[model samples]
Each structure stands twice: as C-alpha cells, then as structure tokens.
Target chain A: MAHILVVDDDEIMRALLSGMLRHVGHTVVESDNGQGGLEQMNAYPAELVITDIFMPEMDGLEFLITLLEKHPDSKVIAISGGYKAVNACLSLQMAKALGATDIIAKPFHTAAVIRQVAYALQSKTIAYRRRAER
Target chain B: MNASQSEQIQNTEEGYPDFAKLTEMREELGDHFLLVMQHFQSGMLARPQKIRQAFQNNNPEQLALEGHSFKSLCRQLGLSQMETLSVTLESMGRSGQLDGAAPLIERLLAYGLQAHCELQKYCLACGKPSSVQ
Candidate 1:
C-alpha cells in the first residue's frame, strides 16, 4: 500500500519488479538507472526504493548513499547479482553500510521480495510512529 | 524455460526457465504474469541485436553492459543456462578479456533464440499471440 520506486538498468528487471509491486497493490515508479532513480525520487518521493547494484551512469551503492544523504528517512532495498571480481557478500555488505534497509540477492523469489518490502515498510511505519510520539 | 533450453536441459537432468517456479509466480501475479512474460519476451528479442552490435564494435564496456543485463533478465526468468553464460560473458567483458568472448556471445545468442521459441510456444499454449519477435 506504499508508493515504491524500483530501479534497474535492465528493462526486464524494471518491468518485473514494478509488475510484482503493483500486483501486491503498491504504487510503483520505475527507472532505468540510478540517475533516473534519483530524479524519480525527487519527483515522486516514494516510501520505499528497490534498486540493483551494478548499473551504468550511477550504480546502486552510490545511489543508496545519495538517496540517504538527501532523505535520511528513505527506506531502500539493495539488490544485486554481484560481480565475479567482487565477493557477493561484500557487495551486499557495502549496500548495508551505505544505508540500505534490506538486501536481496539476484535470483530472488517473489515471496522474499514481498516479505522484505513489507518488513521495510513496517519498520518505516514504526520509526515514524516513534518519532511522532516524541 | 525457452523451448530450446527446455530441450537442452531435458536431454540432461535439469530444465532451464523452471516452469514450476514460473507457475508459482503466475499464481501469485494473476493477470500480471502475462505482462511479465510479455516484457521478458521483448527483452529476449531486442537484446541480441544490442549484444551483436557490441561485438561488432569490439566494445568491451558495451558488451559488459549487455552481458550484465542479459544475466539479470535470465536469472529473473529462471533461464539458468543462459544466466550462467551471461555471467561468464559479463565477466569477460569487465575484465577486458574480449578475445574469447565471441564464442560465448554466439552461444548466448543461440540460447536467446531458443528462449524466444519457447516464449512463442508458451503464448500458443496460453491461446495468445506470441509476444516475442
């Protein structure tokens, strides 16, 4: 029920993620790369973001850092298939350090995606509630 | 899996593009499954040209991009063999090892064609027009 931003350089991935999110009743915004993702975020200001790690123009880690810097409250899910030159765990760890709320590896299942999104959104909601109480 | 991939795997013990997995997705996604398949089919049809153009130009960066994109698409669709091949091609491109990339690229293209055929078959089975070229 949240507005979600899905970013990936692959059209198939963008379509698939957005489709999945929309199927679950989330409003979805899609972008082809991180720059486009940043622009979309500026325009739409989604409650959650799901992004791929490796992309042209700007990759996921940089995007995560930039997003969090601009909107510290932004909830992000970093997804990557990883690189042969870099360890997969390391890629994910970097994403976490950069402020991703969750990480999903490539070859992920639909249930896992839904679960993570829900968890991230719930976490955001709880955090917002706590802040409002203060 | 595409028909060729299914056949390739059937000859062995595994099937590319796991129909069982896709079935689960279809059940969860309902009508959206058609949209997913349609988008995937379009990628399968359009990407080979981009890959070929990258090869013709001997552009490792372009090849790497295409390889990475192909790998992601294949992994999402459960095209295991093609995913593996794309990963290899992606690495080769990234590491500036383009000399041996031609053979792999050819194989990748073949797998794409096979997957496209499979998409056609799937559309037919579903009583819809083929979404792929």
Candidate 2:
C-alpha cells in the first residue's frame, strides 16, 4: 500500500478521503490546504497526493507546480466541483496541463475514487518502468 | 429555480442526510463512518461564519472559495440540496454576480443548521457522540 496525502480546505472531504484511503490499507496524511499539504510532505513525504483545486491559503495549482518543481515525479490527482461560469471539463483540463495524473469531479462515487487512485498509481508505475528501460 | 422548488428540495420527506449514500459509506468504512462524519459535521459548523464574513465584505472571490469548500462537504455527506445551493453560490462569486447572494447564503446557512440537527439525531440514534466539537 502506498502512502497518500490529502489536501482540501473542506474538512469533510478530507475526512472522507482519509477514511477511504486508510480503509484500503494505505497510509493517509491530512492537510487543510496547499500550504499545509506541503508542510506535511516535508514532515513525511507521501507517494501520491489528492488535492482540491479551489482552496484558501494556497490553491492546488500552486501546490502542484511547487511539488513538481521539488519532486517532478510526484503523482497527483486534482479534484474540483467547477467554479461558477467555468466548465468542469475546462477546469480539469487545466489540472491535466499542470501535471495531474488524474482528475475526479465532485459528487463522485466512492467506486470512482478507488478506481482513479488505483489507476493513477498504476500509471505512475508504468511511467517509472518506462524510464528504467530507457 | 423558484423559491418553491428550492424549498421542496430542502424539505423533502426523504430525510436530511442521504441514507443510501451514508449506508454505502458505512459499508465501505464500517464503524469509521461515524467517526468521520462527526469530524465532518464539526468542520461544517465553522463554515457559516466564514461565508457570512465573505458576503459581508463583498469579496466574491472569498465567497466563492467558501462555496467551493461547502460544495465539497455537502457532496461528501450526500446533502444534495445544500450541494446545489453551494454550487450556485460559488458560481455567483466566481462570476462576480453577487446580486442575489445574500438570500442564497442565508438559505445555505439555514440548510446547514438543518443538516446539523439531522446529524445530531443520527448520532443519537447510533449511540455515537452527537456533538463532536
């Protein structure tokens, strides 16, 4: 099981994601926002991070950019409910461009979360293997 | 949507918290559902103040941020009406259209309180701590 970091301003989302991650046998760390997420990583780095796009005290885009600058290979999953006047797909596309390994929209099913997390980790493994071959 | 429709969504006889979703979570997380929900509810209690402040200050960005967080929290607990309301409010903040945000924010607050009461009832029924704070 991999260690995962969860960063979201909403406490409920954090708790739900943490409980779900832990239930699946992975170690989970919680943070309220991007800054806290970075601090947690410094305290104990995680293999993957699931972060919300809109947050106070450091949004996910800045978090993703900074984390990648420090550790380019860090796996991330960006989530959002879409801002008003902004299409959800468009927002997720921005996340993908920013290097999110995967994206999950809000009001997601639990199964989807499991599937996406597993798939993201698998994709990372594949990328790592490809690099080793080269 | 009209006020009647909004009221209908909030006061549906089906109950406050979505049972099907909560049951699914309970099945997946087992006893941890109660613990997680308790923590979630406490966080929700603090949201109104931030939202009200943002609205008062006419900071659409801040209001949108609060709405964004609220939307996510409501989604987690399966509070569909609250989720919808939050999404609308968030959109207003994002688009800088604070025209009707006050009433909507107040409605969101009302639903939040209602949800909390429902959660307390659920906790009491399950023999867990109703007041997690």
Candidate 3:
C-alpha cells in the first residue's frame, strides 16, 4: 500500500477519494487546500499526490511548481473538472512537464484511479530498481 | 446538415467524438457523475454572485476557491469540456489575470449546459430520472 496525499478544496470530493484509496488498502492524507497540501508534503512525504487543479489559497499548478522545486522525485496525479478541453489538456501537459507521473480527468471511476495509482507505484518501483542496478 | 452531419459536428465540437465510449464511460460511472452534477448545479445557483464577483474583483483567491470546488464536481462527472475550461479559469486565477478569465468562464458555463443535457440523455437511456436537484 502506498502513502497518498489527496488535496482538493471540495470536502466531498476529498472524502470520496480518500475512501476509495483506503478501500484499495492505500493510506491517505487529506488537505483542504494547496498550501496545506504543500505543508503536509514537507512534513509527511507521501509517495503520491492527487490534487485538483483549482483551489483556494494556492492553486494546484502553484503547488506543483513548489513541490517539484522541493522534491524532484515527487509523483503527482493531476486532476481537473469544469474546465474546457484545451485548458484541461494544457493543465495535464503542464503537470507532466513539471514531473507528474500521470494525469486523470475529473469524473473518473474509482477503479480507474486505483489502476492509475497502482501503475504509478509499480513504475516508480521499476525505475528505482533500474537505477539501483545501474 | 443531415442527421449524420449534425451528429458529426456535435462530436467534433465537444471533444468526445466517440459516442460509444462516452456512453460507456457515463454508464460505468453513472452514480458518481449524478452526485457530482447535483453539487455542480447547486453550487452554480447558490453562488452565482460570488462566482461572478470573483471574476469582477480579480480576486484569484476567491476565483480559485470557487473554481476548485467546481472543478472537483466536474472531475466526478468526467465533463471534459467543463473540466478544461475550469482549469483555464484556475490558471488565470493563479496568474491574477482576472480579465483573461471571462472568456474561459463563459466557455465553462456553456459546457455546463452541455453536460447537463448529456447527463439527461444518459439518465433516460438507463431508465433513471434526471433528478439533479
């Protein structure tokens, strides 16, 4: 099980995602906003961060920028909803550019999320193993 | 335009050109989508002034909060169009480009309407009521 951080301004979405992650045997840390999420990342150091693109205090892109600056090895899963297609694509591209391992569109299924998270963790492990071998 | 031509136009413009995939995705996540849509519609109605005022005041914080909330709901519904627009608004809010956000906000509002209609069609097809109250 991976230690996951879920950051979103919406309490309901956070709760739902947390529940799903926990149900899949992953430990989840919740943050209501981007700043708090950043703080938690510094303090707790989760293996993965699933954050909504928009937020109060600090937006997801800002958080991502900071997260990458501080932790280059960080794995992020950027999520967006209620944005235009091109804009969402841009956000995803930005996240990928900044070091996010995967980007999932909003309104995603619990199964899909679980799969993505699992794949991310597995990929990280593979990369680590390869580096260690080198 | 004939029926097929109209369908093609609708598909191309909205970004989900594959009707079958869209329908399957909707069906696979119907309950979650409905819940998200309910919150989205209510949030829009409950905070129209707050949303508009945020844009007017160029308050990125307020816009970010509202956009984040809306974005979360959109994520749950898989409303790609709305989600993309929301991301732009979020970015604009982050950059303090309040003026630049208007067009994106308008696009988001339009996407919201389209999402509502699409949800209604899915609900009807699945014999579920469109009770997004």
Candidate 4:
C-alpha cells in the first residue's frame, strides 16, 4: 500500500477523502489547508498527494509548485469542485503541465478516482524502474 | 431550447440518482466504513453541544460560525437534509435572530439522528457492531 496525503480546506472533504484512502488500505495523512499540507509533505513523504485547489493560507497551485520544486519525482492528483471557475481551470492546466499524473474533478465518481490512483501508482513504479536503469 | 424542454433536460441530468455513485465509492473505499462512521459520529456529537452553547451565550457570530462549519460537514457527508437545516440556521445567526434558531436546530437534530441510524445500519450490514462515540 502506498502512503497518501490528502489536503483540503473543507474539514468534511478531508475526512471523506481520508476515510476513502484509509479504507483502500493506503496510509493517509491529512491537512486542513494548503500550507499545513505542504509542511506535512516535507515532514512525511508520501507516494501520492491529493489536494484541493482553492484553500486558505496557500492555494493548491502554490503548494504544487513548491512541492515539485522540492521533490520532482512526487506524484500528485489534483482535485477541485470548480467553485472558482477561472482559477480552478487555470490551476488544473498548470498542474497537468507541471507533471501531475492525474486530475480529478470534485464530486468525483469513486471508481474513476480509484482507477486513476492505481494508474498513477503504476506509472510511478515504471518511472522509478527507468531511473534505476539509468 | 424552449423553456419546458430546457427544464426537462436539466432535470434529467441533475436528477440522476446518486445511489450508483455512492455504491461505487463504498466499494472502492473497501472496509473503511469505520472511518466514515467516525466522521459522522464526531459531527453528530459536537454540533449540538456547540449550538447549545452559542444559544446560551447569545453569540450570533459564534452561532453563525458553528452553523457554517456544521453545514460544510453535512454537505461533505451527503447529508442533504441536515445541510439545508444548517444553512437556515446560519442565515438566522447572520441576521442575529436568535429566537429563530430553535426550530432549525430541532430539524438539524432530527436529521442527525437519521444519519446516525443510517450509519449504524451500514455498520451492522458490514458485520461490525456500532461503536458509539
């Protein structure tokens, strides 16, 4: 099982995601806001990071940028409810461009998310294998 | 599209029952029913006490904050009825209508009980005994 970090400003969202992740047999660490999320990532490395776009203190984009700077190999799954249309769209595009393995929209279907997470983990394994070969 | 056609189309898309989606999520989350239960329990236990305290102190701001938090949690848990009640409570708090909060609080409590029962049923079905918080 992979270690996963879930970050969202909404407490319920965090709880729901954490419950889902933990239920799937993955270890989950949660943070209520972007800044705290970033801190947790640095302190406790996770194989995957799932973050919400709009948040207090630091937004998801800023967190993503900082995270990549520190750990380019980290896999990220960005999620958003599209509450902020322009910003969310832009951030999603940026996340894809910055090498996030997947992006799931908010109110996501559970199976789709699970599939995407599995795909990302598999891809990460492949990348690590290639790196080892090099 | 004409108004009637547009309305029909909107309803068709929006009225798709969420049961299938919820079921898929439940399966994907595997045995993590316990975590969801814990979240529901925390919300169920904390919200009423916070609301009661706010009412006793006559603190509208605190009431509004608590209502907002409760509403957020309800929405997250897919507790639509409770979310609606919490929204009404939030509005009353915003308007400083403390007298209007009691009925809304009662409705919220009723919904909370319903949610608790639903969670319990889910646990029992999973062969896990309900653990009260």
Candidate 5:
C-alpha cells in the first residue's frame, strides 16, 4: 500500500523484489546501484528503501551513509550475501551503524521479505518526507 | 539487529540444488516465475568471460565481485552446490588468496551448466513454453 524503492546492482534482485512488493500491492521503484537509488529517491521519493550492500559504483553502506545524511527519516533495508563466515555479521553491523533501519541476508524467502517490509512500515516512522508535512 | 537475519538460511546437503524450494516459489510467483528464470539465464549467467578473466588475472576485487554475485543468485534459486563453490571463490578472492581456486572454478562451471539445463527443463514443463538457449 506504500510506495517503496528497491535498489540492488543485480537486475534479477530488482525484478524479484519489485515483483514481490507489487504482488502485495505496494508501488515499487527500482535502481541498479546506490547512486542510481539516490537519483530515484530524488525523482520519485518512496516511503521505504530496500538495498544491497556490495555494488560497483556505490555500495549500500555508502548509500546508507548518504541517504541517512540527506533524509534521516527514511527507512532503509540493507541486503548482503556475505562471504563465508567472515563478513556476514560484520557487514550488517557496519550497515546498522551507518543507519540502515533493517537488514536482510541474501537468499531469503518470499514471506520473510514481505514480513520485514510490513514491520518497517507499521512500526518505524516512514522515510519519505512530504514537503507540506516536513 | 540480530533479528534482521531471522530467516533460516537455505542450502543443499547434496551436490545439487533443492528444486522443491523453487517449486514453491513457482506456485507463489506464477507467470512471473518465468521472469526470474529468464534473468538467471540472460542476466546472471551472461558473464563467464568476466569471471574467468578475474580468476586468471588475479584481480581479487573482480573475482570477489563475481563470486559474490554468482553465489547470491544461485542461493536464491536453490542451486546450493554452485552457491557453495561461489561462496568459496568469494572468500578466497576477499582474502587475496586464489590458491587451489582452479579446481573450484572448474566445478562451479560444471555445476552451473547442469543447473542451467535443469532450470530450462523445469520452466518448459511449467505450462509456459520457454525459449531458452
């Protein structure tokens, strides 16, 4: 029911996430990377953002840093595949410190994705700032 | 914050992928299952050249990126064997140690080809005709 932005370097991830969101009746906007995500947010500001951590031009951690700086109220979800045992928790912890509202590990189930989106929407204050409301 | 990764991690015990998970996804996604698989064929597997180049050139950064992307996509589709191989490749690349990576890359390629065939057949049997190459 809310406008959501899904950002990831993977085209399939963008397609999969946007498809899932659309199935649940949420309007979705997709971007290939964080820089593109920032531009999309500027053009079609969404209430929620789901992004991936490792990417070419701009990674998710950097994006979270930038996004939170620009729109501190925006809800952000960071997704990462994580290498073996070494950077799984570390990567996510970095994301949290950088201001991601939530994080999702790669290869997640459909229900899990839907649940996180719902929780972020209902419990947390939205990231999208209406000009009039702000 | 630990709750963010509450979902169970799915991987295969054997050398192949668990298609049952994908079957469930097919039911939920219906026609859009085609789109996901299509991306698997076209978008995901479209760059073996880059992967090989990274591995051969000892470009740890590129190798890690390739491994990260490949394993992530494979896990999503339940291709656990390939996911396992890719994860190893990613770890090695991240650590800047490609020692013994040759055999791993070869196995990943072999498994990847098998996975592609299985996915093609699966999609064709799913009521919609596929133009897989």
Candidate 6:
C-alpha cells in the first residue's frame, strides 16, 4: 500500500478518486487545486500524485512543473476530460512533455484506475533505486 | 453534420444523471452514496457564480478552466445538458470569443440548478441524510 495525492477542483471528482484509492488499500490525500496540492505535499509528501490538467489559480501544468523542479523524485500522473470534448490531445501531450510519469483520461473505470496506480507504484521502486545510485 | 444530428447531440432534457453510471458508483460506494452526491451538489452550487465572475473579469482562460472541470463532473454524473453547455463554454473560452456567451452562461446556470433539484429527489430515495445540505 502506498500514499497517494489526488488534486482536482471538483470535490466529487476528488471524493470519487480518493474513495477508489482507499478501497484498494492505498492511503490517499485530497486537494482542491494545484496550489492546494503543493501545500499538501509540503505538509506531507505522498508516494505519487494524480492531478487534473485544468484548474483555476494554478493548474496541473504549473503544479507539475513546480513539483518536478522542487522534488526531482516525484512521480506524477496527469488526467483530463477537456480533450475529449475539444477533440484534441494537446493538453495530455503537453503534460507528457512537461514530465507527467503517466496520464489517464477522465471517466476512467475502477479497474483502469487501479491498474494505473499499480503501474505507478511499481515505478516508485525504480525511481528510488535510480536516485540511490546517484 | 446535419441540423437534426446537432439537435440530437445537444438535447439536455434526457435526465440529470446517467443512471448506469450512478449505479456503478453506488455499487462501489455502498453507504457513501449520499455523501458523495451531496458533495457534488455543493460544488455545483458554487459553479455558476464562479463562471459569472470569470466572465465579468473577461477571462476566457478561466471560463475554459471551469468548463474543463465541469465537463468531467457532468460526464460522470450523466448530466447531459450541463455537459453540453460546458463543452461550448470551454470552446468559446479557448477561442477568446465572448459573443453569445452571455446567454450560454445563463443556460448553464439553469441546467445546473435543474440538475440540483433533480438530484435532491434521488438523494431522498437513498433513504439517508435527514438534512441533506
């Protein structure tokens, strides 16, 4: 079991994601937006962070950028739903280029969320080892 | 495509939520269903104000940002009209076009309140939350 952070402006979305994570035996932290997410990390860093791309007063992109700059070991997974409506991949693509460890689109199923978490957790070990080597 | 197709896609009167999605979440949440929905209600309540504030501030990016999050919320809940309006708002914000946004914003408010009222009916069905705020 790992500690994870979920950042989204919508409370329901945060509740749903956190609930899913908790049910699977992982401890979860919730934040309303990117700014709050950073604050939560400073208060008590988590093993992984799953953030949404669009938010007010410090969006996921700014959050990801700042997080990586401050904590080089941080593992992040970005999410979004706007791409589907806008019919574009630019946001997710930019998230990848900005260094999200992985990405998941919104309206994801429970199985898919769990699968992504498992994969991200696996990478945690690899990240730690690589850092230890350095 | 055609006007009929557009109308069909934009139809908002179908319902407040996609019952199938609600059921899936209900199965997953068990006792927490009411609480989860209540949380949605409160968040949705605050949405229109924020949208209007963004519009008043002439911040298309903010509108887009709100739409981005709102779209996901409605998508999961199956709030068709709210979801459709949110998409249009997001696109308008992206293009920085304010024309006709006034009416759409009002429509967003209407749909949001309508969904809230409808959701309350279901929350009552949950047989919990004596005082669902």
Enumerate the chain B TM-scores of all models: 0.80, 0.81, 0.62, 0.72, 0.80, 0.85
For model 2, residues A1-134, the per-residue Cα lDDT tens digits are: 99999998777788888888888888998899898888888788888999988776688889988887776778899988776566567877788887889988887777679878988877863245447899
Docking class of 6: acceptable
Tens-digit per-residue lDDT, A16-127, candidate 6: 8887777778899999988888889999998899998877789789999998877768889988875534432677778878877888877776567778888987775334
Residue pairs that clash (backbone atoms under 3 angstroms), model 6: none
Model 1 CA deviation exceeding 4 Å by range: A125-134, B1-15
Per-residue alpha-carbon lDDT of model 3 for B18-132, expressed as tens digits?
3454454444444554453345444534433455678888788678657756655655655555555555566667666676467556655555666656655655666667576
> What docking grade does candidate 5 earn?
acceptable
Per-prediction TM-score to the true structure, in the order listed: 0.86, 0.81, 0.56, 0.65, 0.83, 0.78
Cα error, candidate 3, residue A86 (Å) = 5.8
Global lDDT scores for all candidate models: 0.78, 0.78, 0.67, 0.68, 0.76, 0.77
Chain A TM-scores in order: 0.90, 0.89, 0.86, 0.86, 0.88, 0.87
Q: Decide which is better by DockQ, 4 or 6.
A: 6
> What local lDDT does model 5 show for residue A48?
92
Q: Which stretches of candidate 4 lie over 4 Å from their true place?
A: A9-12, A54-56, A59-61, A80-101, A122-134, B1-25, B48-73, B87-102
Which of the numbered candidates is closest to the native, going by highest TM-score? 1
DockQ values of all predictions: 0.56, 0.60, 0.18, 0.32, 0.44, 0.41
What would you estimate as the lDDT of candidate 5?
Answer: 0.76
- State the weakest 10-residue window (summed lDDT) of model 1 chain B: B6-15
Model 4 clashing residue pairs (backbone): none
RMSD of 1: 4.8
Can you tell me the CAPRI class of model 3?
Answer: incorrect
RMSD of each: 4.8, 3.4, 7.4, 7.1, 6.2, 3.8
lDDT of 6 at A28: 91
What tens digits encode model 5's per-residue C-alpha lDDT throughout A3-57?
A: 9999988888888887778877889888898998999988878889999887888
Q: Write the per-residue lDDT of candidate 6 for residues B1-133, one digit (tens) a residue.
A: 2345347545646437766777677666666566777777766676866777788899998887777778888887888777777777777787788677787778778777777776777777767652445
Task: At residue A59, give the lDDT of candidate 1.
Answer: 87
List runs of model 6 lying over 4 Å from the truth.
A83-88, A124-134, B1-15, B53-61
